[model samples]
Target: MNADIKLRVSNIDKSFPGVKALNQVNFAVRKGTVHVLCGENGAGKSTLMKVINGIYRPDAGEILIDEKPVDIKNPIQARSLGISMIFQELNYIPEMTIEESLCVGNWPRDRYGRINWKEIRKRTKELLAKENLNYNPETKLKELTVSDIQMLEILKAISYNSDIIIMDEPTSAITNKEVEVLFQKINEIKSRGACIIYISHKMDEIFRIADEITVFRDGCVVDSRPIGEYDLETVISQMVGRKLENNFPKEEIKLGGEILKVQSLTQKDKFEDVSFHVREGEIIGFAGLMGAGRTEVMRSLFGLDPYESGEIFIKNQKTVIKNVKSSIDKKMVMLSEDRRRFGIIPVRSIKENVALASLRKFIYSGRLHEEEENKAVKEFCEKMNVKAPDFETKIESLSGGNQQKVILAKWMVTDPDILIVDEPTRGIDVGAKYEIYKLMTELAKQKKALVMVSSELPELIGMCDRIYIMSKGKVTGMLTRDEFTQESIMAYATGTKIQKEVK
Candidate 1:
């Protein structure tokens, strides 16, 4: 064992009923550096991290900390050994206040053996200030957005003051500015000789902060090297086991008449006076910062949230969508950004989930036709390339990318005319992202209108025929495909520049 090695796993192996999640793997992390793990979903990156963090006991392996073997049987034991993890999914009690959530497991107690409210509030405020977060300590977690909750998780992990921090897609839900702040904090942690094991599918973030890179594929490590020795193309090729000629495989389609239009959509503090339209055979994008009201507008349009006042025209006919069922009745469906919360029934099988949205179609004589449902689900799953042992497998058992595919298949079975996809490719790998992009293009070719809300500018520019930029609950500007650039989009998204109309 190397003197500087902070953590090491030797010959680690783990398996589930039908899946070999991890092979005989070996990994090591040194002191005071960012070690990034890059791989497709289900490549065993998270599984390996779980083994080190004591979420899973490896079937065969030895774990060492500080050049000595250590037995980590649980997360508490791993924490005692100076290990803390920030998961990709947000985990927090909705009813708990900020202070309570920040000091959840290790609440401060006074001499009387009672919880110290004063100290908790003081420490929470200090921590929030240090992170440049401007939220009241008494604010409940339910009032916060997905991005805000994700930020608190990051703060909680840092509060542990652990020697080894594992962050799984920490920036997946945050804005680019927040990501900058997080990178600054990571640098500070490194300065104190703490090691970071970061996991992400984002190429830009990987190249920006990583000192070392490890690429995983098919439950094994393909290559590990210094950041300086890798390039974007090389790393991507190693991850998917092949070269991708085009990351965004967009296709040209002749757009038809306007299929859906929204005017003056208002949601009080959430969003106001939002207007946009999508034509048949066209893919439109919504681009903005985290709190810029992009997601809010989409939610209202899809009838997930109530809009104060708005006029919606479907196929040039005024339509009123009061709820999700009404929206679906008008041939509109949405794929939510928070997949775990809104997209899937985790306890159900893939077949059940895929047929959830369109179960009525499978009903005949007051009974669900099992043969018809099975055939339909199997066909859609194959078309989406959802890799799984079988359709009977629980949806939660699959990787993030595969879960997303199943969601897409679910909505496709509904045969919607206008599809609203919010952060469609979030938390998935590069290969899976290309597949999603291809699917979107195919939908456009089929003359289905797509309204995409995404924080990633590059994908929006490549995939959308037009884009509408929002800021502070308002639509600031709209851009055609030719006018789409990161700088121009950011200018509109940040309210630096605004155009009343683009004709």
Candidate 2:
């Protein structure tokens, strides 16, 4: 064991019923450095992290802390050993106050052993202040946005003062400014001789924050080297085991008649007077900052939320979509940005989740036709390139990318004319992202109107025929492909410049 090594795992092997999650894996992290793990989804990155965090027990492995072997039976034990993890999924209880959520395991106590609410609030306020979060400590988690919850999770993990911290896609939902703050915090942690084991699919984030890079594939270690020794191309090739010629496989498709149109969509305190349209075979993007009302607009369009004053026209017919069913009936479907919350039925099997929305298609005489439903699920799963042991497998067992693929398959079963995808490639690896882009291209080729909401500027530029930018609940600018640029998008997104409309 090296003196500088903070944590090490030897010959780690883990398995599920039909999956070999980790195989003879050997990994180590040194003090005062960011060690990044890069791999495709279901390639054992999260599995290995779970093992370290004691959320999962390895069938065969030895974990060492400071050169001494130890058995970590659970998360509490791991935390006690100065090991903390910020999970990819936000796990805070929505009903709990920020102060209570932050002090879950280590609550401050008075002389009589009662919880000291004053001390808890004081501590939470200080922590929030240190992170530059302006939220009230008494605010409930349910009131916060996904990005806000993500930032709080980071703060909670850091508050543990751990020697080894595991961050899995910490920047997946946060804004660029918050990402900068997170990077600064990472540097401060490094200065204090702490080790960081980071897992992210984002190439830029990897190159920017990593001191060393380790690539995983099929539950095995492929390569580990210092950041200086690898470039973007090399790291990506190592991750997917092949060279990717193009990150965005956008295709040209002939535009057809306008299929969906929104006029004067307004939701109080959310978004106001937002107007956008997508023609058949056209992919229109919504680009903006985190709270710029992009997601809110999509939610409203999909009937997941209400818009006070909006006229929705489908194929030139005024359609009233007051709920999700109405939206679906109008040949429209949405893939939400928060997949776990709005997209997936986690406890259900992949087949069930896929067939959920389109169950009517499989029902014959008030009974589900199993054979027909199975056939459709199988076809779409294959079309989406979903990697799973079986359709009967629980959807939660699949990786984030595979889960997303299943969700896409779910909506595709409906054969909708309009598809609204929010952050479609979020938290997925580069290879998966490429596949999704290809799928989107294919969908456009099929003359299905696609409305994409994404924070990544390059993604919108590459895939969208035109983009609508929003800032502070207003449509700031609309740009065609030729005008798409990060500088221009940011100018619109930040309210530095605005255009009422662009055609």
Show the colliding residue pairs in model 1: none
Model 2: per-residue Cα lDDT over 195-231, one tens digit each: 9999999899899999999999999999999999999
Q: TM-score per candidate, in order? A: 0.96, 0.97
Q: What value of lDDT does candidate 1 attain over all alpha carbons? A: 0.90
lDDT tens digits, residues 1-503, model 1? 58889998888899977888888888889999999999998898888988898999999989999989999999988999999999876756789999998888777999998999999999999998987779999999888888888888998898899999999999989877779879999999999999999999999999999999999988888888999999999999999999986658888899999999999889899998888898999999999988899888888888888888989999999998889989999999999988876899988999999999999989989899989889889988888788788999999888777888899899988889999999988887888788788889999999999999998889999999999999999999999988888999999999999887633
- Reference-based lDDT, residue 177, model 2: 84
lDDT of 2 at 183: 95
- Segments of candidate 2 deviating more than 4 angstroms: 111-113
Off by over 4 Å in 1: 109-119
